[model samples]
Target: NREPQLELLKNFQKELTNYKENLEKVEDVDSYKKDVSFPKICKTNDDKRKHLAELFEKELRDKFREHSPTKTIYTRTNQI
Candidate 1:
């Protein structure tokens, strides 16, 4: 129901942020090739993206926990 919808929203947000960050880094690399000596913008972008991904994952996990703890909670079976 709402659980899946919320999850999708969270994922969308995460991907959107990543895309934005990457685009910015690409532009920076192209524009500031001499001014900014970062060796490789792609590398920096990848590192940033990794950190962002981790942060986003934690945030989404926490949100899911608060909103739908049942999503991850496993139950034991009891036979009569």
Candidate 2:
């Protein structure tokens, strides 16, 4: 039983190493492109996304506030 457990751990480590190596080998260009574009897209959709997120967070906070004993505790916490 211990033998199999050890083998599984060894295999997991090997796979993790291989994955990390492969991940490191990936070109940085794609990441650079994604980083550059993602912000632009986010900016473009900022108004809508922000509005929706605020609405959702407000609704969630209200619902949780209703269920929880403390009312003011949740309101002061920083939300997204």
Candidate 3:
């Protein structure tokens, strides 16, 4: 009968409510945005590319250098 379907819907609603409550309890929702600080002035396309490259290199070094010292790190940029 429809009784099983009704019960399933009720359970789904309860779980959705619990999920919303947990999401609202999160304090640092935008904390990821605060982690990276980008340069304010990128006058030309080359400047922007250089800044992004430096940022990528710094992130890679910070994350993987300790784990793999012997591994070589390489970065490539696409030509426009």
Better by TM-score, candidate 2 or 1: 1
Ranking by TM-score: 1, 3, 2
Which candidate achieves the best lDDT against the true structure? 1
- For residues 1-80, could you state the per-residue lDDT of candidate 3 as single tens digits? 55654565565556555644554555543342356454767655445445545555555444443344333442222122
Q: Please, what are the lDDT tens digits per residue for candidate 2 over residues 14-53? A: 6555644554445542352342333333443433344334
**Order of the predicted models by lDDT, top scorer first:** 1, 3, 2
TM-score for model 1?
0.38
Model 3 is weakest, by summed lDDT over 10 consecutive residues, at 71-80
By the lDDT metric, which is better: model 2 or model 3? 3
Question: What local lDDT score does residue 53 receive in model 3, on the 0 to 100 scale?
Answer: 50
Query: Best-fitting candidate, measured by TM-score?
Result: 1
Runs in model 1 deviating more than 4 A are 1-43, 69-80
lDDT of each: 0.55, 0.48, 0.48
Clashing pairs in 2: none
